[model samples]
Target: MKLSKKSMTVLSFTLGACLFVSTAFADTLLGSGYDRLKDSAKNTATLMEKDLKNYTVEALYSLKDNDQTLLQASTFAKMDTVNQLSEENTVTKTAKGETTSSYSYSDKKLSVRKSGMDNTYYVTEYPADVNRKGPAEFSNPFKENGAAEIEKIVDAVVGSLKDYVQVEEGTDGGKVYSGSLSEAQVPAVVNAVSSFGIKQMLHDERDLPKIESDIFVKKVVGTAVENKAGYLENVTGDITLSGKDKNGVQHDLSLNVIVKLSEVGNTKIAMPDLTSAKVEKVSYSGGFSSKYVGTYKNDIIMDKDGKFEKIGERTVVITSVEGDKVTGKYSETVYPGFESEYPNKDAFNFEYNPATSSTFTYTDAKGEQKNGTIHPNSAGKVYFEMNIEVIDKNSWKSSSLKPYYDGEFRRIFE
Candidate 1:
């Protein structure tokens, strides 16, 4: 950001005046430190009573934050003092002064100057209008009452100045000065001088134009996936301006607007192939079981399109095996079953392994031991049959059993 020469001049003067006026009123004006000088200047500007067409003073002052000088907060003080000499003189003399000073605040540099003065000893700090080329032009000096009218003008200007020169919290969690005069304040000062009640003296001044502008923004983006069993696919994007302000000459400001979009729009995902998977055991039964009870486990592999190409082989070892109510562990390699019956198929297949054959010994009613073989005919078919017979037990009979399988699976797209 760049500032125009006129704006720079006004800002410099404003800062200089603030420092000078704040320092002049100190008890030991000649040998006072910066702090004492500021105090004296403010006191003198507060007390001095004089009547002149126009009066101005400028000063430069340093600001400190946590005992450290802040360079950015440093500014010039420029004040325009106006007084109604007499009603008899439509023409009023203008007195102005300029001062340059520097202050380091928080290790930053702030510089300002003060310019423009009038005959009146009372100071009138008007807001600078960047639009206008020169100082505000007034037609006449105002004079109605003796001291009261002059006092009001002085008070207004001083009050505004006092409010303007203080430090405030900055957006960056730092300290800043509120010394810049607003466009309205600039004209108000001029109006105050022209409206003085002393009918003998009258003055009219037009305010200069000042302008300020800024920009900001907020945005949000998110994505959701549905019916994806084990796969997780989510995407999100974001952009923000963060509310930044640009101050200075409007014309000198050049913004390079840049918008970069890496990715946008709908994404394509493939569904996992879930078909032809079989279930082995449902509950504790001697033959092929339909009721898949207890706990089971299986592995499934998916492709880029989220479709399953191959299901890993699993093996379930029965830790304990009983009689007609057989108990043991079952493990199997499961392929992608139909998407609709995934969970059921997945659960059933986990109970039995189609790739391996198992032989178990069971006790019959007569206390004789019987042997039986359990085998899976299909790799992942939904339903399969198994044959079981008591080979060594005389009283035990042979039984053929068919197991029904059911389970589910889900696909994730990224």
Candidate 2:
């Protein structure tokens, strides 16, 4: 397994599935004990999938070198999938006694962030009709795979290091699994962590520990527990590294992590009261191109006789932009059947990612996500277009594709 990608579920020290273990430990030695543990993991994953919504996750990370504590950091987070709300608070202290912290909260309409440096809270208000994302999903502390990530890694590590890892009964009728890694077996793990894990976890890459070519991993041990609901509730790991630098200077490094999940499906996001807090409220375009924040309409259609029967109008309204996402509405009202395909005044969002050819993901009136783009033509004229091949293949509302809607869109309002 590519440990860097998969084992990132938890701390570098807690992740051992990345290590290639040659010993085939006895699965029969513990008989049903092993099967029971495996069953617990499976059940826990199911529980997370079915009932995992609002929850709180706490992860504590500490790095030390011999008598010197290099870094201590903690991250506490709550997520409410139903309301599409989440909040995370992180605090980090360095060896020099310098501390930095930040808290960020996001709901359906607003994204608020507070920093410790100047006690400033930056608030970005989204546009009207913005809809929430998901209802019930659990992800990593960084919102990756969810706390269940630790469960999967633990199961894999235990399976590989059957000889080294042991399992016992947990207090709440859950299970406790522990394992150890020797120095020779931990270099790959530690190196991957230094090269990838630390960078991914720490908000500032400069805080990463300085390690030279010469390396040593003295010890690495971790424990994982399943809660009463069979969910992977907590994980703790400790790692020690001792080695000589190029100049033969002895250095000892230590890393520790404690990760816990609680209040599954009941955790609520307490939106910080900004009434008395230092806040900076600003109204800014929230998309790849703020200039797209306007209404664009195609020319009125003319019949063959050059006389307007029922004018065909295709209008695209980009109402608001915030952080690479734009909320707006699009409608095609072609004559003969002037009833329009999309509903009026309904808002949808598109992730404005210009790197991929300035493409965006916009959901149609039918609630299907489609690729769309809003850009300036060679004439510096902004135009909007969407690929409805999926909509066409599935069920197109129009009698046929209207070319005007896909053609030039002239800005009519801002």
Candidate 3:
């Protein structure tokens, strides 16, 4: 798959950071070159490709002011190597809660479903070329076939290891390592990983974003605790980015992340029934006759002294129609030139009595009766001049004299 330059940079940075943490713990405690935990790391990788792994990750993003949470998300993922399937259920909580579930097959097709408390379900499909493996740091970084470039970077930094310090020893009899790097070291660290070289290795040609001019790492420090198997059990780090905004204002951003793992080689895995879900189609307005019984839109218009005036855009969705009767809903926005008004989308049901304009009763502000009119044009178009006098609840009325739909609208569904 072709990766974007930004994507490659991000991947390289992520790999570098993960390698820094994992390699620090392994090398300081067990020694490098896969001499200490090679068997354990390889065993884990082998099991990952043979069994199922379940992981839960929680991410919280907050602004610097009052630590106000801007967004919070939690994801539960299941991977079954034997069946070559993976699934992720993520619930993102911001102003409201939205859940997105996805299933991926090894052969490269993915099924995704999104459902929220305040919205209807939405689904989409992704072909193989657009999909990629996730959690890119589960394997050994110092292995010859692994992130060898990252290893070289770590080795290059060994001479500059004056900042390495012992954070603590865990109750599990494991040593925790911590280190800090100066801003000057950022370029060397980035260069050590050979981002361009890695892209060439992967056969990608995306141009990298210019990072030296505007963006640079201010400081980076991390602490990690390892498990009995010599694998990092938990790592916490903070990376600060110092840059300038569009307005030329100085800005500094810091990101604190915590990563952990669980349920390796034995995770409960299940796939949902995609056939039972409903599919909703959305597309730009196209020419749709009776064969396209869906939504349509047009600019609202007005009749003034035998002259038609364009006001705003109108969107109508026809659910169904039977024997001169039409039922559906419409939404509209008034143009800036119109008087003070509030836009609204409402439903309406009307029977088309071609001989005598469909007489629909509408209710006004004072509960007075109003008459709404429905006029059908040629085979592919229609118009509704809603009665502004009907006082009926079932009738649809607009705030202006140009009631329901202000002008003619053609079918746009295919």
Pairs in steric clash, model 2: 139-146, 140-146, 286-321, 286-322
For residues 1-414, could you state the per-residue lDDT of candidate 3 as single tens digits?
122333334544543453353333223543342223333344445544443244333333221212333234455555555444556555554423433333232212333334443232333333333323332223322332325675455446443342233345567875565566556655554444433433332222211112222544566676656565555545566655554433455444444566555665555555455466654432111111234356767775554343556767777676655433455655566778564332443344433332223245445344555565544333456665543433232222332343323345786855
Better of 1 and 3 by TM-score: 3
Error (Å) of candidate 3 at residue 2 is 18
Q: Is candidate 1 or candidate 3 better by lDDT?
A: 3
**CA RMSD of all predictions:** 40.7, 16.9, 19.4
lDDT of 1 by residue, 254-364 (tens): 111111111112211122122432212222222334332223333443332323344354333333333233345433444555343233221121123221223455443
Off by over 4 Å in 3: 1-47, 51-74, 91-112, 115-146, 157-169, 173-175, 180-216, 245-248, 273-414
lDDT of 3 at 48: 44
Instruction: Give one digit per residue, the lDDT tens place, for model 2 in 1-414.
Output: 011111233335233432222112323334344445556545655555445767788999887767688778899988776667789988988788888888888876777776676677777676664432332344223222333665454456445444433567677887776656676655364454443443333211223333444554577676778866767788777766565534566777677879888888789886789999877764423223555567777654433232334356767777766555566676666455544522332246555533223345666656756666564431224555565332221121111223222346777743
CA-lDDT, candidates in order = 0.26, 0.55, 0.44
- In model 3, the Cα lDDT at residue 8 comes to 34
Relative to the true structure, candidate 3 reaches a TM of 0.43
Model 2 — which ten-residue stretch has the worst lDDT? 391-400
Reference-based TM-score, model 1: 0.13
